[model samples]
Target: MTTKVLICLYENEVCPRFDLTREVLIAVIDRDAAVLKEKEVVLPQASLEMLCQMILTEGIQVVICGGIEEEYYQYLKWKNVKVLDSVIGDCKLVLQRLVQGRLKSGDILVE
Candidate 1:
């Protein structure tokens, strides 16, 4: 099974803002607790259909993002993928907290 987190960002890496109108970076991990491979996805739209394609194509499980809209969040929840929103700070830190199961729902760094 694959357990992973996808961070929505404008740039290929994490920045101050996710730039909701742009692409998102995908951080993936396999069965092991190590970062397997990292890739970027320039999603056509932040719609549920695009998300479904990402999951089905890449086998992702979680989405650790800076910001997320209500519809996308709902879609992810209904699709059985964990969605961690309002997350900030170091991009890697967010992912680490998630990997260790120490992430909080509303624990986000405000800019």
Candidate 2:
């Protein structure tokens, strides 16, 4: 099985605020945690509604992001999406940790 994950991005780092993120990195990981594919998406604007819509439409299984509101957090949880919120770090490091199964909410991977 494979899991699809989306990481909200701000330049090369995880966006500080999910609702304000305009770019995102989408990746597909296999059961052994090998990355199968990766894609970066740039939204036309920063909108929580649009983000949520994309998450659902893309069939994303996990989301890695910084600060996220309770409503959106609960919404994703209710939809069976695993959300790793309050994560602060570079996108590359975050992805690596995620693949290693070492990532978690409120994680700070930066020095």
- TM-score of each candidate structure, all chains considered together: 0.67, 0.97
The digit string of per-residue lDDT tens for model 1 on 64-99 reads: 666666876787788888877666656666666666
Model 2, residue 45: displacement in angstroms?
A: 0.2
User: Number of the top candidate by TM-score?
Assistant: 2
Q: Model 1 reaches what TM-score against the true structure?
A: 0.67
Query: What is the model-wide C-alpha lDDT for candidate 1?
Result: 0.64
Model 1: which residue pairs collide? none
Q: What C-alpha lDDT, on a 0 to 100 scale, does residue 28 get in candidate 2?
A: 96
In model 1, where is the ten-residue run with the lowest total lDDT? Answer: 12-21
User: All candidates' lDDT scores?
Assistant: 0.64, 0.96
Per-candidate Cα RMSD to the true structure, in Å, reads: 3.6, 0.7
**Model 2, residue 7: C-alpha shift (Å):** 0.1
Off by over 4 Å in 2: none
| Candidate 2 local lDDT, 1-111, one digit each (tens) | 899999999999999999999999999988797889999999999999999999999999999999999999999999999999999999999998999899999999986
